[model samples]
Structure formats: C-alpha cells, structure tokens
Target: MRGTWLRSAWVMALSVLIVASLATVAAAEVTTIRWLYPGGEQPVSQQTWKSQIERFAKVHPEIKVEVIDVPWDLAHDRIVNMVMAGDGPDLIQMGSRWIPEFAEMGALMPLDQYFGKEKMSLYYPGLVKTVTYKGKLYALPRAYSTQALIYRTDLIKNPPKTWDEVVTISKKIQSEHPGMYGLGIGGANHVSTLSQYFTILYTYGGRVFDEQGRLQLDSPEAVAALKRYVDFYRKDKIVPNPLEYNREQLPELFSAGRIAMFVSGPWGGRALGLPPDNDRIPYASAPVPAGPAGTATELVSDSTGIWAGTRNLKAALTFLDFITSPEEQVQRDLIGGLVPQGPTMATRPEFTKNPFFKTFIDMAPHGVPQPQPALWEPFQEVIVNMVQSATLGMVTPEQAVKQAVQELRAKGLVPAEKK
Candidate 1:
C-alpha cells in the first residue's frame, strides 16, 4: 500500500510540471505594447478605455496592450525624460502643436509607410496637415476641434454675421440685461487666449508666419485684429473683466447667466447639458463673425504616434489602426465631446443632425491651423502676453504688436526683413 501511494504522488508531480511549462510557452507567444495616454484619467474615461482594450484583445489575441494614463500638465515633461533616456512607451498621445517639437527630437517614427494615400485620405486634409512635420507624417489625428459662437437664443434672435454687428449687438444686449455682460473673452495667460486671438487674426488676413515662414505679427492686419479685440473690453465695455477668465471659465460663466455669448468648441454644448437633439438647450451655435478677410476659426487637434525605439512596431501599428477606425473614432467623439475627425464620421446622423455639432462641422472648411514652432511654449507666452498687455491698458495695440515682434526677433524665432 505504501508503494502504491508513492507512485500516485509521482504522477501528480509530473502533471503539475507539464501544465506550468505550457503556461510559460503561451505567455512568450504574446507581444505586449505600452501606450502613454494623456488627459483621460477620470473613472468613466478609464472604464471606457478598458472596455476598448478588451474588445481589441479578443480580435488580436497575440497582442497585449498596457495603457498608462498621465495628466495633461505633466505629460510633456514625462515624455521628454523617458524618450531621452531611451525608455519610452511603444505608443504615445501628442498635441498637434507638439508634433514639430517631437519630430525635431528624432523620437517619433515616420508613419508615411504605414499610412499611404488611401488610408491617409480618411482624415480631414487640414487635420492631416497639422500632424505632418517637414514633409513627413508622424502621427494620426485622434481628436479635433474648431471654435464657434455659442449664444443664448433667448437674448439675441439673430446672431452677428460681421465684426461690426458683433459689437453693436453686444452693446444692445448689455444695455437690455441689467447685470449680465454681453460677451465673454479670454484674456488669461493660457493657451485658449492664443486660440481666441488667432481666430480674429486669421479673420483679418493676419498670418503669424508668412508663406516663407517669416514672422508678421506687426503687420497691418495683425494690428487691426488686436485693436478691435481689445476695443471690446476698453471701448464697447460689452465684455466683462477678461483678465479673470480663460476659455474653460467662459463656458461656466455663460451657463450661470453671467454672459450672453462666448466662443468655444463642441464641448461647450456638453457643458451646458445640450443633448444630441438640442431638445431643451437655450443656446444656439453660429459661425464666428466675418471680418475684412472673412471668417476663420482656430483648428486644434490631438494625434497618436509610435515611439522610434519601440520593439513591437507591428503590434503598435495594429493598435493604431484599430483605434482610428471609423466606428471607434465616432464613439470617441461622442464620449469626449470632440468634433469628428473625418468625413465618414462627420456625415453620421449623430453629428450632421445635431444642431450644435452641425454648426461646427460647417465651420470646418474655414478653419486655420495654429502656427507650428519648435519652441511653441515660449512663442505662445509672447502671444498671450501681447493680448493681456493690450487689454489691460498697458500699451496701445500698435506698440504691443511692435514690442512682441522685437521679442520674437531677439529670440531668433523670426528672420530680419529683407531690405
């Protein structure tokens, strides 16, 4: 009986060894890729992404994806450090403006090979241009937005169609409403301030960089744009203290009935609890007022790229293709309150039929992308300061523009004029 018990124990040990070996072989067959995602850390955002990964896993059982969520404020520095150390993730989310900076660093993979003309044509041409740096495509657009006028329908039956009309209507609105302001403009030292100013600048035919990439911030068109924008606060007095507000804050102020109108992206509707059908929302969206040059809105986008040092290139490309598919893109737009990135998703009933989204979609053709500079942060600082100084009565618009031009020249961001 004792010999029989020993034989049974030996058989059990052999079976355990075989099972462990099989598990190890299975694990080795799968490729794992790391994705550094920024600005979706909330519980709902987290769950949504988790579900997406699970769905992808079922289709590509040979690949395993690990997502790392990082806050927006810290993502840039973290990515720089990791890339410099040669320890970066396989995939990364990038702000469109950062594409030039990253491409210059030689840390991103050129994606033209993976996405030919056929696949590249899936995105808006303007959006695709933003992700291209020095003639090479480095990323695929994942999020896109363009600004528009969001006004209270109860206050103004007809939205302004021209710059003069905007000011005139605003003055009347302010007079009718005792305590509330007519418009909210962002003057804080934030990126939104730059975007707001760009809309006006482009509308007036002002180009920050000429076709040859020379700075023109002090041009006649640019000066006129700034003067008119500052006049809203100083001359017309239809806008509140802009020094206290940024783009994000203006929407809240509008919701609280402190202001009758503001310019924002599609997310503005979501902030005001606007449904897809525009059911009970009191606000309506319209194109930005046209200027001498015509209407132009700042086009902003976020894109995804693969790190140059990634070992799992094939897996990274597979994940990129999966996430950027038409169906996935539509779902992301709905959940994040972003504009559709391509025509396929834009034509969907969810966007084309929705009044608020349709307005932004119609405005996409007139969108102007932000200037791409390798030193974007410092360049943005100069533009923001220019707006703030002029609005706060620190200097005249002409003087402000001249001073900003001098600073840009000193920083070597712009070349001296060809005399």
Candidate 2:
C-alpha cells in the first residue's frame, strides 16, 4: 500500500511540472504592453478604459495591456523624463500639440507607414494635421473639442450672432438679473485662458504666426481682440471676477445661475448635468459670436501614440488600431464628453441627434488649431500672462500684446523674418 501511494504522488508531481511549463510558455507567447494614460485617474474614466482593454483582450488574447493612470498636469514632464531615460511606456496619450515636440525628440514612432491614406482619411484633416510633424504622422486623435457660446435659454431667447450683440445682450441680462453676470470669462493663469483668448483672437482674424512664421500678437487684429475680451470685464462689467475663474469653472457657475452665458466645448452641457433632451439648467448652444473677420473657435485634440522605445511595436499598433476604431472612438467620445474626431463619428446618432453636439460639429470647419511651438509651456505662459495682465488693469491690451510678442521673440520662439 505504501509503494502504491508513492507512485501516485510521483505521477501528480510530473503532471504539475508539465502544466507549469505550458503556463510559462503561454505567458512567454503573450506580449505585454504598457500604456501611460493621462486624465484617466477619475473613477469613471478608469472604468471605461478598463472595459476597453477587456474588450481588446477578448479579441487579441495573445496581448496584455497595462494602463498607468497619470494626472493631466504631470503627464507632459513624466513622458519626457521616461522617454529620455529609455524606459517609456509602449503607448502614450498626448495632447496633439505635444506630438511635434515629441516627434522632434525622436521619442514617438512615425505612424504613416502603418496607417495608409485611406485609414488616415478616417480622421478630420485638420486633426490629422495636428498629429503630423514634418510630413510624418505621429499619433491618432482620440479626443477633439471646439468652443461654442453656451447661454441660458431663459435669459436670452436668441443667441448672440456678433461680438457687439454679445456685449449688448450681456448688458441687458445683467441689468435684469442682479447678482448674476451676463457672461463668464476666464483670465486665470491656465491653458484655458489661452484657449479663450485664442478663440477671440482667431475670430478677429489674428494669427499667432503668419505664413512666414513671424509673431503677430501685436498686430492690430490681435490687439483689438484682446481689448474686446478685457472690455467684457473692465468696461462692460457684464462678467464677474474673471481673474478667479477658468474655463472649467464657468460651466458650474452657469449651472448655478451665476452666469448667463459662457463659451465652452460640447462637454459644457454634460458638465452641467444636462441630458440630450432634459436639461437641469435651461441652456442652448450656438456658434461663437462672430467678429469683424468671421466666426472662429479654438480646435483642440488629444491623441494616442506609440512610444519609440517600445519593444512590442506590433502589439502597440494593433492596440492603437483597435482603440481608434469608429465604434471604439464613439464609445470613448460619449463617455468622455468629447466631440467626434471625424466625419464618420459625426454621422452617428449620438452626435447628430443632439442639438448641442450638432452645433459644435457645424463649427468644426471654422476651427483653428492651437499654435505648435517647440515647447508649448513657455509659449502658453506668455499668452496667459498677456490676457491676465490686460484683464487685471495691469496694462492696456496693446501694451500687453506688445510685451507678449517681445517675450516670444526674446525666447527665439518666433522664426526670423524672411530676408
């Protein structure tokens, strides 16, 4: 009986060894890729990404994806540091403006070879251009947004069509409603400050850089735009303390009935807890008020890119394709409160059926992409300071613009004037 028991134990040990070896082999066959995700730290955002990975895994079981969530503010420096250390994630979520800087650093893989023209055509041409650096595509657009004028329907029966009308309506609204501002403008030291200013700057036919790449912040158009934006706070006083607010805060203030109107993206409605049909706050969206030049809005996009240091290039590309697929993109857009990136997505009922989204979609053609500099932080800082200075009565709009232009020139951000 003892001999029989020993034989059974030996057989069990052999079976365990074989199973362990097979498991090892299977693990070796699977390619594990890491994705550094920015702005995914929120619970809902995390769950959505997890679900995406889970779906991707069911389709491509041989690959495993690991996501590292990072805050938006830290993502830029973190990515740069990791890439420089040769320890970057296999894939990264980046602001479209960062593509040029990363591509120039040779830290991102050129995606043109993997994505042919047909595939590239799936995205908006302007959005695609944002991820292209020197003829090479570096990433796929994931999130896109264009600003619009969000106003309280109860306060204004019709949206403002011109800048003069905007001010006029704002004055009327504030006069009727005490303790409530007619407009909410942002002048905080933040990126949204630049976005808000740029929207006006573009509407006034101002260009940060001319075709020759010369700085034009001090141009008459730019100066006029800035002056008008400041006048909303200083001269009209239709807006509250803009120096204390940013774009993100405006939606809340609007929802609380503190501001009657604000310029924001499609996400503004969602931020205010307004469903497609039933809105908690009675509001409507319209094209940004037109300037002398015409209506214009700031076009912003976030993208996903393959890291140059990744070992699992094939897996990374596969994941990128999977995540950027039309169905997946739509799901992500809906969950994130972002506008669709291309025509195909715009056609979806989720976007087309919604009036607010439809307004932003119509405005896409007039969208102007943010300026791409070698380093966006310094450039953004200069512009933000310029806006804050003007709004705070520190300087006239003209002087603020001139100082900003000189600062950019001193930093060598502006290209040399053509000989």
Candidate 3:
C-alpha cells in the first residue's frame, strides 16, 4: 500500500510539471509582425533585407516578421487611401514631411513614451527628429540618406569650400575640361530632388516663411540666393544644355568625367564607372558648403510608422524596436544611403567608418532644414517651373520669384510676409 501511494504521487507530480511547462511555452509563443515598405529593386529589398529580418527573428524567437513590398510610385496614394479606408498594414513607411500631416490627423501612434530610458540610445539624431513632429514622435526611422557633395575629387583636386570658390572653380574647370560641364543637377523627380536646391536658399539667410508663418521669398537674401542658382545655369553656363537634363542623368555625366561636381544625396558615390570605395577614381563627399548661416545641410528621412487604425499596433511596435536595434543597423541597413532611425544606433562603428558617409554624418545632426509645408508638391512644382522658366530665359529670376509668390498667395498657400 505504501509503494502504491508513492507511485501515484510521482505520477501526479509529473503530470503537473508537464502542464506547467506547456503553459509556459504557450505564454512565450512567437508573435507575427507584418511590415510594409516602399518597394525597391535593389539588393537591399530583394535578398539582403529579408535575410536580415530572418536573422533577427532567429535571435528573437518570440517574433516573426514578414516584409511586404509596395511599389514606390504608388506608395503615397496607397498609404493614404488604405489608412483612410481603415484597412492598412500594421506598419507603413513614411517620409519626414509626412509626419506632421499624418500625426495631426491622429494617423500615427506617438512613440515618445516608448523612447524612454531603456531604448533611447539606438538611433541617429537626424533620424529621430524626422519621426518627432510637433514634439511627439509618431514613427521611427529605419534608414536615411544624408546630403553630401558629389564631386570628381580627382579632377578638382581641391574642390570649392564656398559659393564664390564654387564659381571660380567651375569657370576654370569648364575652360580646361573640354566637352565637360563644371556642375550638373537633378531635373528628374523634382519631388525627390527639389529640396537639394531649396536647402541652399535657407543657408543663404533666406527664409521661405517669416516668423509669423508667411511667405518671405521677396527678401534680399532670398533674391540673392535665387540669382546665385540662376547664375550657375544661365550666367556661368556651367550646367549642361538646359534641354538635356533630369535626375540621375548627372551620374552618367559624372562617371564619364564630363562634369566636375554636383550636389546630391549620398547615393551619388555609386555611379557606374566610379571605382568601388577603396579603388581609385572613387567618389568623395562633404557638407553642402556654407552660405550666410555657415553651411546648413538639409535633413531628409526614411522610417516606418504604425498605419492609422492598425489592428496590430503592439506587434508593429515590436518589429520597429527590433529593426532599429544597433545589431540590425550594421547587419542590415548600414549601406551609404541607408541609415538608422534611432539617434544613437546610427553612430555605431558600422556607420562611422566610410569616409564619404562620415563627412555627411558630421554635417547632418546640426544642419537640419526647416520643415516643409504639408503641400510640398504644389510648392515644388511652382519652384521648378519658376527655375526652368528663368533658366530658359523666359523670365528673369526676379520675375520668377514674383510670379511664384503671387501664385502662392493667390492660392492662399502662403501668408503675407512681415506679419
């Protein structure tokens, strides 16, 4: 009878242990996270990024992330429509300018609460500011492109450090390098490229908006900057035939040794003929040089935000935290144009090493540009036509600025300056 009682007790204990273990396993089961990003054909999108997330999942066995790519061209409309219709992904990729507009509409979850003591030291400053709009962080940047000077360093040997020097160098290079232009610019995809030109206007002590939030394009500093830009294409003749240009076209010209320099994002270094980073004929970069404000560079961003009305907020935030971790930055997103979202994670050794990116990193944290208005597209279109019209001699730079101001005011897009 004693033996029988002992065996029964052992069996009961074993059953309880198994039940407890099973409950523990169930409680710690993995969660599924869905991610949506603007699509890319680059290796970053196709193979590398997927494997990266999978590896992250390996270490974090409690979460499984699935990436769904959306066409870049349709990303804007798709995201807005999906969110408006109340059926979007758990996460959405967003641009810096989109933060304010979306957050104001309650489309994003403020991340400030989550960025407390435990996880604050994992991103770059530029990336952090992008998601923080009106003092609330609505998203977290995963990677970003820093502004840089893309010049044929070998030819210029000593590139210009200021506007006046830029002009002098261009004039000499134009005369010496036959069939080559001194400078070139992006005309394609003005939405993506226009800021490269606009940021310079601000650094010249030109304000697009007055302290009262009114148009201030008529300021003398503004006019001077506009004239300086027009001078490059019109007066200096350093740019290519105004008819044969657009974005990415400069890369071909630059790689062929046909242009001395250009202002572009970090991606410019990878133009085809340019040798790899360690090779000769490789590209180099620096801050977009000083103007009146002493060398300001524009802030640009790429990040993931929770889509409005997502059914899986908790899951999405988990995935965001994982991707923005320092390990993933080096293992996944540390390519030159690709940057981390957290202020601390971006400065890790992986991001600080490349010379071209390092120059950009140095300038980026302090030199953020002014926040563009929600309707940047309309303003962008007006600026392009204005610049092109002036460049093609259809109008004076003064007349173009006047027309731009008039058009904006007529639409009530800009308030009167001097408010």
Candidate 4:
C-alpha cells in the first residue's frame, strides 16, 4: 500500500511538470511583431495588405504580426505621439520623405548593418538617397511612383517630348476638341500641386535648396520655372480654371476623356478604368517633358523601417527581408498597384507585362526625390502658397518668388541677410 501511494504521487508530479514544460515551449515559440501601415484602414488596401501578411505568416509560422492601420493624414502625427509615449510598433510603413524627419529624431534603426551599402545599389539612386540621412540608411523601399505625361493615345498620335511640345500639342488639342483642355493644371493649396510643379522646376534647373542648404526661392532658375508654369495658366490658356482646381480633379477629368494630356503617376491608368496592361488601353504614358536644362520628374516612394526601440530587431529584419525579396515584392506590387523598387523585380516578366509600368521604370533612373528637410512640410507650404499666388494673379511670378524668399527667411528656413 505504501509503494502504490508513492508511485501515484510520482506520476502526478511528472504529469504537472510535462504540462508546464509544454506551456513554456509554446510561449517561447511565438514572437509577435507590431506593424503599422497608413493604408490599413481602407477596405481594399487593408484586405490586400493583410493577405500579404498572411503570406508572410505562412512562410514563418513562428512569427505573429499584429497590424495597425492608420489614415495617411493622421499617420505622421500618430506615429510621433506613439513614439513619444514609448509605445511604437516594431515596424512601420512610412513615406520616404518622412524618413528624414523620423531618422533625424533617432527613432528609426540604422539599417546598414542589416541591408548593407552593397544592397543599396539594387534600388534607384534617387530612392536610396531619400531614405538616407547623415550617411545612414534608415529604411527599405517597398514601392515607388514617378510622374509622367499620361495622354489619350487615340487623340495624340505622337507624344510630346519637350515642354514647348506640351504647349503646342495642348493648344492644338484645345482648338480641335471643344470643351477639352490640353493640359491639366491645379493651383489649390494642396501638397500635390507642389509635386506637379516640381517637374517643371527641376526641368528648368531649379531647386528648393542649393547645396549649402540655403533656400533658393528667389534664384534666377526658380523665378524662370515659376514664370513658365504661370504662363501655362495665364498666358497659354490651355488649362481650364487652373486657379480653382486641385490634384484629384485632373485625374478624374482625364479618365472621362475631358482632357487630352496631363502628367501623373501609373495610378492614373487605373483611375481611367483601364486594364494594367497599357497595350490594351487607349491611353499611354511618356516621360515628363524636358526643358532647357534636362528631363526630370518627382519620384514618390513608400518604405518599411524597423523601429529603433524594438526588442525584436532580428526577427523584424527577417520579416523585412521576406517582404522585400524579389518574388514577394512582385506579389506586393500586384496587390498595391505600385511600381517595383529594384531592377530584379522591375525586369521580371510580371512587371514587364504591364506596359504602362515601363514609362515609370524608365523615368525612375532620371527621377528626382522630393526635398526631405526636417522642416519639409513648411517648406512645401511655401511652394504651395507661391504657386497659388502666381496662378491666381495675386502676385506676379517674380513677386511670388521674392515673397516666398521672405516667408522662408522669416520662418528661419533660409539664411537671413547679414545686418
């Protein structure tokens, strides 16, 4: 009887030990990664992104990803608040332009150790430049967008290659097609208006800041660029109600065939109710027209960065590598409607099959990154107000340039004149 009682007690104790060991193993196997993305709130966008995350989960069963979707308008401020509260996610989908601000704050991981300078060569030079601050790489680009001249192929037999051609073709189209404008223009106080104007400014050898980080709003190049853009509205008269429109209006008008030609990204093709393959579509794209200086356009990119505060840095980087792998990158682009980031993915059969993607691809090498100063938003506002003033006849382009310089100087963005 004594032996029987002892054996039963031993068996019960062994059972308890086994259960505790199994529970510990299960807990150790799971590593949850917090991910934040701007598109997580949109139904279609969220669904698509979640599907990709599910794919990652399948490949790495040990990792669990929790997603937080925030709206684009609120994402920056929200992230700042979260980081300040010491509760930021392990990974984030951030705008390339935002990288500079966030990285400067020391909130992002220096990714050179994970991604390396050698791998940086795989991406467009302009895109690589956008995520680098003070010689440190802070993020990995997932997708990119660049502006190009999107025109109705049935209307334009030959695409314009120069800004002068854009004017000539637009004027001819306006004369021939009643109620149809030649060029799509926007002057509303929106950031996109500034992006559209950047094409023209860059083509004319103008820059927002010189190499010395001094504001160049009143530079001769800047004055000329602004004057030429205003002429498209006040002088050419090909753009309809240029002062009253915003960015969204032009894409919609183009889709309805109300405009003959305009500049936009590949997303415009989708907005037109056309298939992804341009060969089957009635509209096609060309590089943004060249000016006296050279060809140029704005390169828009969204990147994924690991948070500097994450405890799961190794696993986070593994996840980053998985998402950016060539095969997965193509899958992500297909769902997101983004251009591929690197040559390996760009040259893939899947991407090359879509002809509209070709123009964006060609332009990527020659593209210019948007300015990424810590105070870039305020700087962008200066351009917005300047363009609005010039297009609305509130000020001449020369006067607009001078006023912009003054505003920037007062904001301490530009060097003040010595007393």
Best by TM-score: 2
Report lDDT (CA) for all predictions.
0.85, 0.87, 0.68, 0.80
Per-prediction tally of clashes: 0, 0, 13, 0
* Per-residue lDDT of model 2, residues 1-419, tens digit only: 99999999999999999999999999999999999999889876797799999999999999999998999999999999999999999999988878867887889998888999888878888788778776788999888999899988877899999989988998898788888888998888878988899999999999897544557676999999999999998998889888899999998898788999999998888888776345556888999999998999988998999999899999999999999998998998888878888898899998897887799998899988777765688888888889989888999999999999888877766644312
Candidate with better TM-score, 2 vs 3 = 2
- The C-alpha stretches of model 3 lying farther than 4 A from their native spots are 1-31, 60-62, 117-127, 210-218, 242-244, 276-282, 339-351, 409-419
A best-first ranking of the candidates according to their TM-score comes to: 2, 1, 4, 3
Badly placed stretches (over 4 Å) of model 4 are 1-21, 210-212, 276-281, 414-419
Worst 10 residues of 1 by lDDT: 410-419
Task: For candidate 1, give the lDDT.
Answer: 0.85
Cα lDDT tens digits, model 1, 152-234, are: 88888999998898888988987887888888999898888988889999899998876455787779999999998899899
| lDDT of candidate 4 over 150-234, digit per residue (tens) | 8878778899999899899998988888888888877777667877788889898888765345566567888888888898878
TM-score of 4: 0.89
- Give the range where candidate 4 is weakest over 10 consecutive residues by summed lDDT: 410-419
Judged by lDDT against the true structure, how good is candidate 4? 0.80
Expressed as tens digits, the lDDT of each residue in 1-419 for candidate 3 is 99999999999999999999998897668676666777644565656567767777777777777766777767767777877887777887766667666776677877787766466556555456666765677877665665667776666777678877777888888788788888876544356445655667767877676534567776777667777777877788887764466655777777777787877666666655454353545567767767777676666776778876776667777777776667765555544355444556546776687777677667666456444454555666777777677667888878888898787676555533211
